[model samples]
Structures are given as C-alpha cells and as structure tokens.
Target: DQQVKQNSPSLSVQEGRISILNCDYTNSMFDYFLWYKKYPAEGPTFLISISSIKDKNEDGRFTVFLNKSAKHLSLHIVPSQPGDSAVYFCAASGLGGGSEKLVFGKGTKLTVNP
Candidate 1:
C-alpha cells in the first residue's frame, strides 16, 4: 500500500492565480514533509517543507500547511508563474527514526498557463 498519495494527477492554473497542491499520508509516523519540483529532464528540486510540529510555513510566494489530525498537507503558490509548471512530489520522513526511508507520493503535474 502506498503510504503517501497525491490524489490528483494534474492541475492547471492561470498565471497570477493560486495553485494548491494536496497530499495525504497514511503513516502517522511521518513527521516531516518535503515538496519537490521537477522539470521535464532535470531532477526534482526542493520547493518547500514543513514539520509536524508546526501548522504552517511560508517562504516568498510558497506556503505549506500541515493538518496532522487529518494526515493532510498542502502547498500553495500565489501568483503562480509559468516557471512553476512542473511535476510536484511529496516526500515524507520520520523526524528521528533510524531507518524509516523516505516515502514519496506519485507527483502531481502542475500546468501554469500565462
């Protein structure tokens, strides 16, 4: 069974609009989240992150919100730009587990139209 899931496979948003990407986890032990953006040929690049202890974290135009009780997390990008169009993946890991490998969800492809 997949521990992490991005139910939506694709999302489209107009430039300058808000793009919200959602992820869900089945493992409560997951204490951290890493959102990565991948272009067509390059490796995934870190976008934003959040720890289970905090409900929200923001950086520039990107914000991440965690709802521990619901096992859900979301990444919001305001004023979405064309450069933001990519495959976004959600990876989760335990805060201090010796060997709990990172669990990644199937990415959601985001298309930002200018």
Candidate 2:
C-alpha cells in the first residue's frame, strides 16, 4: 500500500518551455516528498523536496508543489533545457523513522527537444 503513483510514463517538451509532471499517493502517513532526476544507467539524483508541513518548495529551475488535502503533488521545470532530458522519479517517506527508504514511482521520462 506504499505506492506512490506517477500516471505519466513520459513527457516531451521544447527547450525553453515549461514541463510539468504529476504524482499521487494513497498513504496518509507520508510526511516527506522528494523528486529525483536520473540519467541512463546512473543513480537518481535529488532534485527538489517539500515537507508535509509546507505547500511549495523550489530550487532554481525545479519546483515542487504539494497538496496534502488531495494527496497530490507536482513538479515543474521552467525553461526546460536539452540537459534536462532524463527520467524523473517522485518519492515519499514517513517521518519519525530514521529509515530513509523512499517509496518511488515508476518514473516519467522527460525529453527536452532542442
């Protein structure tokens, strides 16, 4: 029941355009939300994150917005670049446990066309 869901398996956008990815979760105990970007054959790298207490978090080109009431979250990349083409994973973890085991979605592959 710890499934975090990313409905879209892929997204494509032109360079310098905005890219949006959506995610949902069913577990109410989850208190941390994270997004990770991954290149082929490489480990996923942390992007942006928001705690359950907050509604929005941003990091340069990346932003994450969480709506706990609906159990939904989204990631936005503004002015996407060719370098941003990669798989993005949305993850969540419960607080109070030092265990950093993150439950991840299948991932959405974003291709930024130049």
Q: Rate the local accuracy (lDDT) of all candidates.
A: 0.92, 0.92
Residue 49 of model 2, lDDT score: 86
In candidate 1 the C-alpha lDDT for residue 55 amounts to 97
Total clashing residue pairs per candidate? 0, 0
lDDT of each residue in 30-86, candidate 1, tens digit only: 998889999988999988888888999999999999999999999999989999999
User: Any idea what lDDT model 2 has?
Assistant: 0.92
In model 2, which runs have C-alpha deviations exceeding 4 angstroms? 96-99
Clashes of 2: 0
Cα lDDT tens digits, model 2, 1-114, are: 547999999999999999999999999989998999999999999898888989999889998999999999999999899999999999999873325878999999999999
Q: Name the weakest run of 10 consecutive residues (lDDT summed) in model 2.
A: 93-102
Q: How do all models score by TM-score?
A: 0.94, 0.94
Residue 34 C-alpha lDDT in model 1? 84
- Candidate 1, residue 113: the lDDT equals 99
